[model samples]
Each structure stands twice: as structure tokens, then as C-alpha cells.
Target: MPEANIADRFDLTNWKTESLRMTAFLSPGSPIPQQNWWEEICGSPPEVRSSQPRTGVQQDEGLFGDGNTQGRLILAVQPSRIDWLLTVEVVPTSFELPSVGSFSESANSFAQLMNRWLDVSPNLQRIAFGANLLLPFEDVEQAYQSLPAYFPLNKLDLKNAQDFNYRINRPRNVDYDISDLKINRLSTWSVMTFTAFQFTNVGSYTYSSAPLNVAIRLELDINTSIDFSGELSKDELPKMFAQLVEYAKEIALKGDIL
Candidate 1:
């Protein structure tokens, strides 16, 4: 990755989070009853579902939500890992982002679910927390010019910079209870023009294209280091989540200024 040199502060008005997720991995895993696990979180019988390929990596996906909200809660599980996606559309029927109040409320709701899951699940090899956010631009030309502000493309001409992306993965020592515990901080951000196409229905789908849109898309993933072979106890999850959220906010807020 190229070094990031601060040039100018980018405008962060109208920015919003696209989604947030928390995941836990259990090595030497076993298949738990899908219905039992679903009922644990939802406190209701599992709804309609489908099975995955025999060799699939991540299997058993169940979506939780009513049709009235802007997003749905997704619980996807593989043999070794369980993922909880808090605020993302199932098929993405719209380009709407969560409002300020809603985003905060969503985060709080997600945390509640995370704590609930931790109460039952145990012996996790690793844990991860992530966020996806968007900061829209008025036009493509303006977006192209603003790329250099938060990205390391100040030396290059924006005219030639198409399909631009900047990503980095590094280890940071977290100030937590565990001794010498390092967390992997991964982030990817881009400024691009997007063409939206709405997908209707499932299996067989029809699409209709919308107007072109430009925005700065940001992704941040914070997780425990793979180097540590030890497992994280259930009691440690809430504190771990808090620490990860702090790190995520620190990185995500950088685009607001430098």
C-alpha cells in the first residue's frame, strides 16, 4: 500500500453508515441445529430457508426482520464461524442510508444482540467487527477531485485515475486485558461512480437501471490476530466489542478531517 499523506480535509456532510456486523469463529466446530440457534436469538421458530452446497464454506443463512423496516438482520453460519449482519437490505431494493438517529439506534440494537449471543455461545477462536459507510458526492467530477484528500493519490492526475481503491491491513496492539494482544485492522475505501440497478424478486429476477451516482464508500474490519491460537472467553466479548468499536470509530472518523 502507498503511504497516505494528508493533503486537504474532505467534507463529511451527509455521510452515513451502510451497515454494521459482528462475527465470531469457533474452530473444530460442529453443526448445531439451525432451528435451535435461530430460536435462541429470535425466540421464535425458524422461518422458511434453503440448504447450501455440500462443500460450501459458509452455510445456513436466515434473515430476521419485518418488511416495514429499511433493513434486515442476517444470521449466517458456517461450520466454524457465525456472522450477524445488523442493518443491511436483504436484496437491496433501495439506495437509502440510515438516518443519524436510526444509525445510532441500530448500533445499540446490534450491541444488544451481540451480548445476547455471547451469553450462550462460547469457545471462540477469533472475533471480528466491521462497518460499511458511504459519503455521497454531488457529481462525478467533484468526486474525482476529492479522491486525493483522504487517499494517497495526490501525486497523480485524477483524469487517469479510474477504478481507484486504497486498502490496508496491519496489526495494532490493543490496550485490553489480554497481554500483548494484537488486533488486525483492515480498511478499504474508494471514490467511484456507481450505476444502480434494482433487482426485483428472487431466483429469477428483473432489473431496472437508475441514474448514475457517485460517492465515497468506506469499509473497516477490526478483528483479533490469527497469530494468537488461544480462544476468547464469552465474558471477554463485551469488552472486546467495546475496544473494537473504539478502534473503528478512530479510523472511520479520519475522513471527516485529514
Candidate 2:
């Protein structure tokens, strides 16, 4: 399919993406070698970083940047689960019309990089892949108002809430065990809290600032897991991802669910 065809489907405007991640889960006891894997695949050493507390995985992460492609690769070891993960994140240069081709090419390159790494560590088993698309709106109220035009609201109780926020989580195909395909509305708000100190015998109250022009976020996370015992090929990886992107667009344009 032509790149412009995919780009036009979203009717994208000025927007920001947190990151686009593609991950592979290795079977237990299959550890990556301590050699120069990044240097061999990326032609340079990756910038190292630490894991966050929320991730629950205490491991150093290797990050590589491709200036030519404007993409990044993150490789991290999950000690808790005995798995290794490889993630690729790419930022769009032109917000007016983001190029899906660039993202696809980057994903294909990442798959090739993984294939090279697998050459040395052949014991690794099982592979699961997924992507996330985050679209932000400048006026969340207006964005919410426009949802009815796309989704069929007959099954949805729109009057239940004044400021509408809804979510749908369902499997795309049961036989493949593919899941986490969702369409939802998200918002940002503030909260007030009070704190008390025992030693000082004093109490204090605080309130967060009201959110400004931050846009309402619409997130779609699609995932699929497969057993490693089956055939693994990089040729079809990009095609599968493209299909997922198209599926997401179809949902936004013609899905019946709210």
C-alpha cells in the first residue's frame, strides 16, 4: 500500500507521540550474551540508562539512536521475568502529515537487527510484538463532541456523563489469541491533598494546578503473542504491523462501539 494512503486515513494534525515501541520476549533461561551486540548491529555503542521504579525490572538499558532515520532502539533485560526486550521509538518530523513509511522501515530494520542478534543466541524462544499510537487533541471537549460522527452510539449511553469518557477492550481474533485492541478516551485533571507531620504537629494542604491547553489523549495499544516453535521470519513482520495500523484506522472511522 502507498504511504500516503495510510497517512490520509488518520487525518493527522499537530500532535505528539510519547514513543512507538516494538518488543520481543525471549524464553526463560535464554540470556543475551555480554558481548558487543549493539556495536555489531547499530555500528555504535548505545547510551546506557537506568530502569524506573514502576517498571519493577531492575536492569540497565541500552539505547541507540539512528540520526539518519530519526529513530531509537532500547534493549533491556527483565530480571524478574527472565526475558529480554527490544523496543524501537520514532518521532514524526512533520506533524501535518506523518509518514507511515518511515515508521514501517524503522520497524523492518529493527526486525533485521533482532535476526542478527538471534544468530548467536539461538536458544531464545517465543516472540510477542505490538505497537502504540497516541493522538492528542488541543480541545478535548470538542474532540469528545466529534466522536458520535464516527462511532455508532446506539449501544452506548451517551447521557450517562456530561463530560464523556469511555473505553472498549476486546480481542480482535480469538484463534490467534491477539488482544488488548482498544479504543478509549483519556483526560488530565488535578487533585487536592492534605498532609500531616507527626514530629512538627502541623498540617498542610496543597492543590495541583488546573490543566491548561493539554490535549485529550486517544490511545490504541495492539498486541499479539506467538510461540517461538513456529516459523519466525522478518519478511512478514512489517506487513503485519501495517495491517494493525489499518485495523486501528478502520475502528476509528467505522467501528460501532463507543
Candidate 3:
């Protein structure tokens, strides 16, 4: 493809600006469950009874699957507890640049940076590298601006994921089902948006969220229930955001689209 196509399609210049919103939720009470925790299955829980579905599969079977799938092992917040859900949602809004190719390339670069960040998070370290990789998502407000010819965008959406259920219980996660893949004229820049909801592992926390819900659920089964009722400080949000902005700037400047 032409250089203009490549640059517009893969560039991420606008997202590096300091206008997007990002947030993180931390849970500190759920206890990590080990193999010994499930000594007594006792059938299933109430959530299973009330879960909505129209397929032919049983609820437990659908949720837990056949049990032989790789990464499909059961997770108990505690040796004997499965009562609450904890979830953390980090929403980052990025802007695409003039070249669709560059925008797409920048989207990929942004995803890569998040992958590297996961590698450093002490809580997410145990999970396989690149197993449940992050993906760029467009915010609802940006749906209209995501048109193919728009070229650049005011904001791009994305998510950080962990212990994906389909991967954990279904042997492998080889499907790319999320729609809205915008590849520029030269096929260099590509952007996609989607959502995920489930109870899962994060560091020592067990978080849960529904695509339709507003507040993410967080669960910790630690010996002592975690309490953050004003025990923490939050004056560093700006500094952290500034650092991420620099990271994005560096990536856009490098202009590598492989």
C-alpha cells in the first residue's frame, strides 16, 4: 500500500494526547482457591439456576464445560466459598490520526504496550503471556466516528483482560469473534472494538462484571476481608496518565508496522 495509506491506517498520534479517561478498580478480599478447595462439589450454585440461556447445553456444562479442556480448571475464591464477584474496568479513550494506516498501526502498538504492561503486573503475572491479549475497542460515543473513511478519530476504546472463560474452560481461545475491524486502504492500520463480562482471576483478586452493569464486582477471599474505605491515596492518576501518553508518543514516532 501507499505510504499515506500506511501512515493514516496505522498511526496513533491523537490518542497520545492528554484528554482520554482511564480508571482501575482494585479488590483485596477474595481468597485464592486451590485444588483442595473443591473437595465437595455439592452440585452447583444459585447463579447457575438463574443464568439466562436458550441453548441445549446444561448451565454447569456450559459454564464449566466438559472439564477436559486446557486451562478449564475450576476457580474458587476460597476453599469453600463462591459467593461474591469483584471486577476492575480500565477504560482508555484514544484518538486516531489522519492516516488510516497509521491509525491502525497505532492501535496495534497500543495493544502491544498493554500486553507488556500485563507482564509487569504482579497480580496478572501467573497467566500465560499473550493468552488473553488486550484489544482496541471504540467507545459508544465514537461509534459514528469509526467510519472507514473518517481516517482519524477523537477517541479509541480498549480493554485489559485476564483468565478468559472461553480459553480457561474451552481448551483454547482461537476465535476472533469481535466485529468492526477497520483496516485502512493498504491493510496496515486495523481497529476493532468489543466487550467481555465474567468473574475471573486478577492477581489475588476475583473480579466479575456484566456488560450491562455499571459497577464492576470485586471479590477477595483473603483471611481478612479487604477494606479500602478511604485507607488509600489517589493523587497519582495524572502522573500515571502522563507516563502512558509518553509511551504512546514513542510508539507513534517509531512508526513500525509489522
For all predictions, the C-alpha RMSD in Å is 5.7, 10.2, 20.8
Please list the residue runs of candidate 1 whose C-alpha ends up more than 4 Å from where it truly belongs after superposition: 1-13, 27-35, 51-69, 90-105, 151-160, 197-209, 255-258
Candidate 1 contains a number of clashing pairs equal to: 0
lDDT of 2 by residue, 1-258 (tens): 111222233443222333344444454555544445556766775677555556544443465444333334565555323233334343432223222223334444445555565554433333334333333444444444344433344433232235554556444542233233221222221111212222323254443332333333344444443422443334544444445454544454444343
Against the unseen true structure, what C-alpha lDDT does each candidate score? 0.64, 0.40, 0.25
Higher-scoring candidate on TM-score, 1 or 3:
1
What TM-score would each prediction reach against the true structure? 0.72, 0.49, 0.19
User: What is the C-alpha local distance difference test score of candidate 1?
Assistant: 0.64
lDDT of 3 at 232: 19
**Residue 51 accuracy (lDDT) in model 1:** 56
Full ranking by TM-score: 1, 2, 3
Check candidate 2 and list the clashing pairs.
Answer: none
- Candidate 2 CA-lDDT value: 0.40
Question: What tens digits encode model 3's per-residue C-alpha lDDT throughout 185-230?
Answer: 1111233333344446646457654342111111101111122232
Count of residue pairs whose backbone atoms collide, per candidate: 0, 0, 44
